[model samples]
Target: MRIITGIYKGRHFDIPRTFKARPTTDFAKENIFNVLNGYIDLEDAIALDLFSGTGSISLELVSRGCQSVISVEADRDHHAFIKQCLKKLGTDRCIALRGDVFRFIKSCHQQFDFIFADPPYALPELPTLPKLILERGLLKPNGIFVFEHGKNNSFEDVPGFIEHRAYGSVNFSIFSNREPEGEDE
Candidate 1:
């Protein structure tokens, strides 16, 4: 996978064949960032990347100028690879952690300006993720959350639902704690 833009733009990382994680496609990644660019500023924003397969999203977050990024991946190999990548990049902006995403969510008390989760689509707990993260107060008042899932899931009816975007088979549901414009009391 390769970063689409920012300081690390044009850099590429090779994924091992034995890995089971599905790194977000370049097409989907590019398009999602395009959509995000219209809504929030990445510069100086503290971000979190859960289910951080290959650490692609975390690296991208740092590339785009996020003040800091925390990447959580469960697999030992994947976690090591992420650390290796960070070292190669000579960047201290991202922290790679090895652990279960759900457990991390339940224990995390700090809020972030931007959060992204790209859990396995087939994972049974997929549906509950948005609610779990949002309910835990993981997002600051104006923070944005982007959850990546398969086409089978829909979050339009959920609270904080901003909009949904699709790129081929990839789907992203965006949410924010702040009310949409013109809805303020």
Candidate 2:
């Protein structure tokens, strides 16, 4: 896998052959970042990466200058690899956690500026994550959540869902907590 942009742009790493998590494709990651770059000021953003396979997105967030990135991966091996990658990057901006993403979500007390979830497409709970995050108020006002899934799912009708983008076989549904214009009451 490769770090597509930011300070670590073009950096490459290999996933252990025994691993099962699928990292996001570099092409898709690049395009997604291009979109994110237009909106978020990454330098101070506090971010969370769920199902952080290979720590790909987490690393990108750090390299792009997010103030802090918390990466949660349930697999022990995957979590270890993430820590190794973070060490190799020589940065103290990311915290790699080995735990269930759902448990972390339910128990997390801190709000974030950005959140990204890339759960296994086959996960039965995939469809419910948006509501779970919203109901839990995990994102600060105007915060964004990007959900990556296979084409089998659609979240356009879900509250907070603002846009959808498809990059080849990978699909992303973006949600935001921004209040609609002119409705302060």
Model 1: how far residue 78 lies from native, Å? 0.8
Task: List runs of model 1 lying over 4 Å from the truth.
Answer: 179-185
lDDT of 1 by residue, 62-148 (tens): 999999999999999999999989998999999999999999999999999999999999999999999999999999988999999
Superposed Cα deviation of residue 37, candidate 2 (Å): 2.2
Query: How many pairs collide in each candidate, listed in order?
Result: 0, 0
Per-model C-alpha RMSD: 1.3, 1.2
lDDT of 2 by residue, 9-105 (tens): 8888899999999899988998988887765677889999999988999999999889999999999999999999999999999999999988998
| CA lDDT of each prediction against the hidden true structure | 0.95, 0.91
Q: How far is candidate 2 from the true structure (C-alpha RMSD, Å)?
A: 1.2
lDDT of 2: 0.91
What is candidate 1's CA lDDT for residue 8? 99
Candidate 2 clashes: the total is: 0
Measured against the true structure, the TM-scores of the candidates, in listed sequence, are 0.96, 0.96
